[model samples]
Target: MSAALDQTGSAGHWSPVESWSRDELESYQLERLREQLGRLARSPGHYGDLFGRMGFEPEEIRELSDITALPFTHKADYVASVAAAPPHGRFVSVPMSEVRRIHFSSGTTAKPTPQFWTQRDLDRWADLYARTAHAQGVEPGDVFQCLFTYTWFVGGLGATLGYQRAGATCIPAGSQDTARQISTIFEYGTTVLCGTPSFIVHLGEEIEKRGLSPATSKVRAIMVGGEPGASVPATRKRIQDLWDARCYDFYGCLEFQPIAGECEAQSGPHIAEDFVCAEIVDPDTKAPVPDGTPGVLVVTHLDKQAGPLVRWWTGDIVVRDRSRCGCGRTHARLVGGVHGRADDMLIVRGVNVFPSAVEDVVRAIPGLGDEYQIVVDRSVRDDATGFLKGIRLRVEGSDPALPARLAEAIKQRLSIRAEIELLPPGSLERTTHKAKRLVRADD
Candidate 1:
């Protein structure tokens, strides 16, 4: 009944999918792609209509490269399809009666979008979650504390199933209630902590407020996702110091909950190449870029039942390294761990800036707290031209010199000057779930 045995199944232990040669892996991918295609064609969904409109026949895909023939599935396309078809949309691959769960995106930019999952889809999601946990060194005896939101978000489901797959006990510590979170760690001897990087940092601050250090907790490792912080050296070290635990980074999207994860080496997160195919391409030209080149992240789901995504363009900017990692997983790793987003780009005084870039600077400063917001102020606007007033940073802290120091650091790193305003230590609101990084302030 050990985790290793559980993963091995009765046949053997551990799946060697990552260890397969390039050709072998591609062959498997092609098989999965074909199976998904046939299912899509048979189902009454938008994908089948899309494939037909493009004159693409599933039989025509003789090789993996032939996937390029299919048209890309854009999120806007899904939004439109939902408006036209209603509810789950025609893109759903299963019968409407089979869907057991429905999750909504936070959708800061627009209204929340609906995603449906059948029992089969949930099962696959659990398997992927578990695979990541085991790959990241989650052991049989470890106790995992799940602190993500389970109300409408998909993250909690991923952590719960992953712990179950790894044969570890999971404490369902839902988001909110910081005091309860701190008590559970010591009371239950939680060995694994999983949540957003900001929340983890806030948890550390709360623990310290009670005259306790991170070292006093039994938790040994922290898995961070839903935001970019663990990849940044300063933030990673801060959280590690908070609880004296190892930090691991995970990358996933609302479209696909589990994409890649960092192994013990902590170099970068390895892509789930088996289930998903990732490509870095120019955000504007949509052309494939070199492995290490920074570009927009484009994902294609090779396996999925409820929502079959084909060449879905994710708006995030990133870099990938396919070189073999020291951890021995042959899957590609994400470099810089989601540097920024194409949509979140800010034009501040003729300089292009990202919220994450500002974050890198803020989290590195000593006196700053977790709750912070960036504002791109616009003095005047017209149809022809606009004036760049400046970018203002409102951080949670009361230190007298912290604002000047933070502004100087940002100017040095981004080559763009920023105005910092320090608020009371607990003046700004803290997020129990996702951290909001930017707010527009125009005057």
Candidate 2:
């Protein structure tokens, strides 16, 4: 049995709110929302003006559903607000003195969304992340190596603080030195490996190149976040087989850091209901979808102190299931982790292809290297629709017949023909930071 699961049956519970019923959770949320709205009402920021314009009295939210009546917050709005005001802008609810941490989105496309966190907010984040590590079975005396970047407006610092709070020794080795990261794992007996699924794969490839046996390694778990991979069946299975560890998926965004994640049961990632009120809604209409249906995840911060967002659209697609988990938590669990970002979907030949879905196919193939890139060329071949879209999947593989097989798998899974180009090992670039998936040939 897994060390975390065995401990979960006895001493693995995180907080009292985890056992609360929906009624109790909702009631608690309403009270907190009242408090949150009242704070925003008196604050000097975009949120205050937003609430005032809605004439939304804190006490007026008699039920949780009343939140829908308010305007939904989007990333574009934050970018514009911050661009006009600079730095945090009116989006910051707390004064400059109260804010201690500043985080920003990847800024890959548009302007980065700046996130402000007060000292108290950091503590709460630590608490939530502690629960995340504990959920995956990290206990006292265990060591966790954090391979994510540690500087700037990134998510790595939170995991570092979180594991320390959870009573585990944290090794802050941001993806720079692969050799050192591997040596630290065995030297420190690191029990938990926290990083993106792509980097984990890179580490596995590095291990094999060094002629080392991971079965003899001390690492026991892998907590994946920052990009989709942990829940991708093929991706997760590959990581599991490589390190022989329990892999857990974490779900959250720059606006809301580490809100939901998986437990030892590994059913799915459970959202912190006491802190975040989550809803899965249609990506287009923004209307609520029935449980177990995939939709854009809209979230509201119930306990955030710096910039408590309400009805913020997270762009990531997920399904919420309230089924009781064997781990004894009633918090809502994302059915299949995050499938893909609505914005990241690639339309090829009138067919939608998610990068993660493509990853599922790529990772399942044996002897395929850890790196892969998807490029969609609009100028390739066009029919009557004016878009003869072609998807080129560049993967690191030496097998001559691998391209044909991969093309067939991509065709079968995504229902679209892809031109697969297999390269020798290490042909594709690797990343210590966020792995770039789509390389647009149109540029």
Candidate 3:
């Protein structure tokens, strides 16, 4: 059966729920939230203990707003629970027998947080991914080459199943040799390329070195996530120019398999309202903020059966728009993708700076390479305040005049002067997975 037929069986969306009104979606969410809370309350695990300590009951959750009364679940909490419990941790709601798979976080900042998925959880994950894929225009006969790693990371396996479920042929080409991967793109007539934006940019450069034009390749769409590049205007334009295809953002993390995704309209990623109830709260106060306000994102699984997360603090900074999208999705849209991770924010001379903001400035300049790094040199600390003395930007660009232009651009955009250092192309290290942008010189 064709993907279109399957998606349209019940309604115009992949599932009938995607087109639901705000009231319908909220009503469904309330029902599922109660069930999830009830399950967590009944489980002899961490959540039950937490609820008992707070004198909170599942029945007390009369409405979604009441969820605010519960304490937020942080990554540290899961790590601590894993340390206390042996295998799956005390946060899991289901038995080990029902768990069909285990995936871990990238562990870039901390140890990999173990995630368990039962058969039902895996099915829901794939179904939600299928919905996202369909919305992003994945269909039968489209060959999707997944460049995400397949080891323990959730991105690779989830994307493979989701695209396949959307009726696309998937090649699980985990991040390995870029040359071989590029060869496979042509060999298999791959119609879609999936991976981090950095890898795609690197692939495009490699294609140029091989005397081939990426724009002329069979790939018609580039589905990117796991980092913040595709949503940035200059970065998005670069990828689109390199591949001559539409660049769609697939936003999710290990904790949430398929949170939100961009439709064909490409306005922004629409949250999976029926799958997860998303909340944006002040990072400091932890109070829910109004829609369209930038704050830390908190996610709760609505129907997850295994390790269900209730108010999992994502720590990702984003703005939520609850208005209907041009594509008719009533689900909230994450404006401009994730602004930046709350922890990733840098304080430079009393000015708040996000690497993405610098990236926007650097990538906008002509003749600059795709790779760049931000350095926080602790050696140059202020004697009086004991704070950062200066910031430096290391970039790959041959033009001597590039540094001056970049410095001015950074100062104008960020309101802080940045020491710009220009290096020859290929000086900076490249990666196939998530790219690290910030580095402390002291480390």
Candidate 4:
């Protein structure tokens, strides 16, 4: 067993309850809430506007639970606010000169959303990430190969800084040139490999194509993010089987950095209550959902000084389990990490199919990576009136023959025939940031 697995086995039995009592955790969250609100009140423009709109003084929010009374901030509001004010947007707390770095959202739906970070904000972000890495068994002297993109997106830089803070030597190999990444993994004796679930599978395939067995590779732990592959049983199993490494899942967003993360036990992602306040609510009524019930995830950043967000509505869906996790952390746990985005759900012929569901089925097929895309287009021929035409899926595959086989399997599983297209191996561009898997041609 690898060092990470050994640590996981040893620490797996410890529950989050052992780390802190419920009262103690609540106290800590309340303290952080005061500090964050004070910082927001002192800032100029946007925060003041929000506070005025809420018709309450920042001081009125004494306890952490009082945060629920505040109105939720949606992505559309932030985008509009930013458009009205260029560059940093009204959310920026510090002056432009004080800002050290800028990170933008992957913007899978529309234009990318930009987030500014001061040196202090960066330090806090890194510290939280380091805590997560250490809890997951990444140790000092361990070499980490960061496979996420290092462009405007925050995943690459945030992870690299966090790993470095944890005393790991990170190989800044952003997602590109799989051959070179595999070569570096061997050369540097990297112990931890970090990337999206799909990219990791692609790297594994490249390693096999180059006559490399990932089981014999120096990598010991694989950390995945940017998607829900870690929570999916078949997809997670495939990645672990391919890399011969302990796979840990982390769930976060551009609006709120590092909301919840996995430890060695891999039971679920533990929410970082010290830094974030999470609310699982029914997407339709905006009412709190019972524990274990899947709902829309809303977040509030507690320690962010540069661009502190309050009750930010993240379009992701997840189930929150307040019961203690297997890991020794008092924070709430996301039972299966992020299930899927609210917008990604498709109702096909009285059956609901999420892109993630399709992805799970596709990834389960042997010899296929997570590089496929679902193309939905309107049927060119007019159908009979009163019956709406359903969605079509054009799955991208590396091998020319795999699409037909995959279509057959999907038909058997989903009980619907989906048009599958087999493009060239590199036909679909590999992205280092968020993988754009679902494309609506009719839109």
Model 1 clashing residue pairs (backbone): 8-13, 45-90, 46-90, 214-243
lDDT of 4 at 108: 66
lDDT of 1 by residue, 1-443 (tens): 24454544222223566556667777888888888787787666787877778777788888876776776778888888878877666677777788887888887655677887888778777777776777767878999999888888889888898778777898888888999899889888999989998898888888888998878888898999988888877778888887889998888988887888887789888888888877788888877889888888888778777777888888888889988777666778897788778877877667777787788788789878877888755532232466444578889876798989998898899887777888888877778787878775653
What are the per-residue Cα lDDT tens digits for candidate 4 across 1-443? Answer: 12233334334322232266668877877788877877787668787777777676767877766887788888887888888897557888878888898888767655777887788888777877776787778888899999988877778888999888777998889988877898899888999989998788878877888887988887888889998788887789888898888898998877777787787778888888777878888888988889888789988887777788988889888888777666556678888788888887665665666677787778777756457788776662125542213445555556677767877887788765677666655667766556777877766
Pairs clashing within candidate 4? 16-329
Q: What is the lDDT of residue 223 in candidate 2?
A: 91
- Poorly placed runs, candidate 2 (over 4 Å): 1-11, 110-113, 348-351, 379-381, 387-390
In the range 415-437, model 2's lDDT, one tens digit per residue, is 98888878888888888777888
User: How much RMSD separates candidate 4 from the native structure?
Assistant: 4.5
Best by lDDT: 3
Report the number of the highest-TM-score candidate. Answer: 3
After superposing candidate 4 on the true structure, give the runs of residues whose Cα lies further than 4 Å from its correct spot: 1-18, 62-65, 106-112, 367-370, 379-391, 395-429
Ranking by lDDT: 3, 2, 1, 4
* TM-score-superior candidate, 1 or 3: 3
Note the clash tally of each candidate: 4, 2, 0, 1
- Candidate 4 achieves a global lDDT of 0.77
Using TM-score as the yardstick, the better of models 2 and 3 is 3
TM for every model, in the order presented, reads 0.92, 0.93, 0.96, 0.86
